[model samples]
Target: MSDIAAEFDFSMRSHGIALEMQQSNYLNNRICRPLVSAQATLVLESANADLLWDQLRRVAYVPGCSKRLAGTNWPDPQVVADELSAFISQAEVYYRAGEETSGPSAALQYYYSLLNLAKAELLLWRPDAIINQKLTHGVSAVHATGNFEDWRVKPQRGGVFPLLYEKRMGVPSSHLPGEINPDQLFSRCLESGMEYIQVRGKTLQAVPLYQTIVTDGTYSWSHLLIEGYGVIQQNKPSWDLVREIFEELPPLHHGNPWQVFALSSRLSLDSFALLIPCDGKYVRSGDGIHIGNLRLPEWEEELAARLRPMLGHPHGYFDGTLTVSLSDSEFVGLTSDLARYLSVYLVSSLIRYRPSALDLRLNPDQAWYLAAFTRQAALPALQSAANEILDNEFVFLDRVRG
Candidate 1:
């Protein structure tokens, strides 16, 4: 939802009830009732939310899903993931350094990374998963960004010299997870678009827009600031072709069709976590903490700057939940929290109602044609459909491609 929801609609999202929509009465009495009922259910054959919680903990970060640990040792999924990712990452750093083509933990991070992708794969098949499937890793895009690889090449003794250190096996990680085949990714993205468009109430023959990965990562998306938004497939967005029309692009549109804020391996081996800067460049925020351009208000910029000093979060964007720990109330009160959360609701809804048109078998060429048309002005019907919900209207920010 970070930047992704900005592209679509969000007013329809809800978790039965979101934090922003919380009711005090429900929070106090209603919350405990579900716990009691779940616990009581365990009394018969199997109603152990605690046990569920335990096993789930082995994998998941959330609680109350099981019985055995329901009331005793409550651990936040957010915090647990944060801690586990860090613990595993630390174990990985040491293990990657010490161990080799031997046992487990060496590839634990690798497997964990793929495990995430596997989960995404499960979600992808679901009618609502945004990406039809997590783009399967094709060839390595390690050289694409030039930010990862050779993470820590420890020297090893070798050769004629008794104590001359030769470099050990280097780590191979990319600044972005673009090992994804674009042909497949763009195609599936359009499929998602078609379905999304239809959900807003539209039935056009097709939509053609230069699908861009303005920002892609494990937990964030910001396609709102994309230049190739209105691209047609036959006239695809290549760096060369884009150079010609780059001048004509809107302020929000970054030059290329794709602009990933991939997390570099300087952080971890999983992959570059992403943060699409609407502007082509990611501005430095000083110190070891680097951030790209976010469309936050000036006041928030000042706020983030002030908080940055007080908050010792090196992995602010990367390994949060562990560092800069926060209480449930504190996390709930965050501005970006609800927006980040809406993705969950969106995915669940997508799964429940597998809408047609979101089919992955979309034609990029045809989709681009629609993009060209919409660039001029919204087709009367398409515009109507996009705003069908009335209260939820598209916010194109500026006119004249400025």
Candidate 2:
């Protein structure tokens, strides 16, 4: 075996070996389940499109409801509320129509539904900026060749796309590339990750994240760790690679950036663990003050809140494992909301203008792949928009019938 591999093995075998096993079991059995269950209990559940539409419509008619729901106020609460209701009503029409149809026609209906929903959100948040102006789709197709993978979409400088980008990322859309590969967008989607892997035979852009708290009978600290070090090309995982991955992560709302530490000795090659020091202090040993006053459950809640922004709850359902990604050359840096929107936009555009191209894409062999995109993409987009509008992460629960 290589020296790097041997060092990694030894370190894994020796350093905190007992703690490592304890942490793993604790994370799997204790930490992950309750955190996900608690989140699930708090989210709004909807079994069908009608239920979802009703939930959203109720929020739309009330003045300053966005502020009340999400903690941010609209400038003209009544006007924005009225406009929001109208757009939502129209969006509901398209959404319902899309549900009843299939193929390219259904795709177009879903696109319009999402479009109106996006407009409602834009008006609610940026009333003065978009209320009276002529807004374009803000995104366009670069190439609509017969093959969908070969196609690309470009973001225009001015339009709803850039505005939404600015709203979500706090960065101007101009910073985005002149053109983006649809495949890259596909790779980042939580719903489409499996499809991406099946077709491309490569890992999705996201990395799985696991969390655990380690204690020595007196003092305890929470740690975030990622497996699958495929991002590190070399055998030895360098501090530089660790830092690069850390830097690519989205910034936390408050507090200092989490510190990266090697669980293994510096000489080790493969794996690493990151310490998210509570209150910005590294507690390597018992020298640091203990968290004796805080209950373990409370500490877990605190950690979940801190990491919520970076966590990807696949399809709005909190599975125990969350995901984060290292930005690569293929990544366009769009937020998940924007990625879903643009992805749907690309398909809708194809269906509308290039019917023959879409027909070719829906051939027997690839039909299931395209079907997955259609079936899975839109609901997340709506949920994301609703979250933005209400400033809350909402999950759909199936209605139980007696």
Clashes of each: 27, 1
* Reference-based TM-score, model 2: 0.67
Candidate 2: Cα lDDT at 239: 28
Worst 10 residues of 1 by lDDT: 160-169
Score residue 104 of candidate 2 by CA lDDT: 45
Q: Candidate 1 versus the native: TM-score?
A: 0.17
Tell me how candidate 1 scores on lDDT: 0.23
- Per-model TM values vs. the true structure: 0.17, 0.67
Most lDDT-accurate candidate: 2
- Give the alpha carbon lDDT tens digit for every residue of 221-269 in model 2: 4445544434333312232333433332221211111212212223332
Give the Å error, residue 218, model 2.
7.1
lDDT over C-alpha atoms for residue 169 of model 2: 60
